[model samples]
Target: MTASTLSAHHVGITVNDLEELLAFYRDVLGLTVVDRFAVGGDAFADAVGVEEGRAEFAHLEAGGIRIELVEYDPEARGSPAAGLNQPGATHVGLAVDDLEAFYADLPESVSTISEPRTTESGTSILFLRDPESNLIEVLES
Candidate 1:
């Protein structure tokens, strides 16, 4: 239960298009592609808690963290935008060695949301929203 004992494994987000999302994470953010998989038949069906009998997913690694991007078929189920940024919504905050360099390299759309400020706890950070409006925090180390 201590800080040293608590570890973050990965954060998963459902996206509408796998290729587009992969481009953003891979090219724009400079994350490395770690793994990818397409699942179908009974194994996928049971593992994902889905009745579609298939699944598609990719994994990206950046800043020592893993991001899992999932793309399910349109008719498979609900909407991806349904719970984004709601009151109880959760997003990942990543720490960077060079905050200024990271900010400078971001695209216009992503840069626009980089409102740099200091937290009450005295941590320097910049906040931005992804294409999906998921709040992302880049903290200065």
Candidate 2:
């Protein structure tokens, strides 16, 4: 596509556990796995900004949102996930008809920042971290 024809693409998240994260998205979140592939070598490393990086990647999509999961070389894993307030960090937001019910149904392993609360705008919202500490926002639809 030309520069003037640019459009939105997928959001990429580097993960420590590809399989687990893949399962979380595909099973728990109900996203469909669209593609899976592996890449490595100098070109791959240069393109991904990881030195000597080889990675397995999966693309998942549903409800018009697409996500790309990348697992870097096993021996050279990255650091802990960044907090939401940290620069350059991004979080995913989702809507549910019943925020309280959704929060209650979440697996015990999922850690939330706090109980669901009503914001100034009157939207019931909650924040939870995924297995890998990636922040997610859940709001009442």
- Model 1, range 1-141, lDDT digits (tens) per residue? 565776788899877778887887788777899999986887777787777656578998877889998887533554444243665666667788888788877888673454567779989898776675666778998
Local lDDT at 54 for model 2: 96
Worst window of 10 by summed lDDT in candidate 2: 74-83
TM-score of 1: 0.77
lDDT of 1: 0.75
Candidate 2 vs. true structure, TM-score: 0.84
Clash-forming residue pairs, model 2: none
- Model 1 error, position 72 (Å): 1.0
- Return the lDDT, model 1, position 19: 87
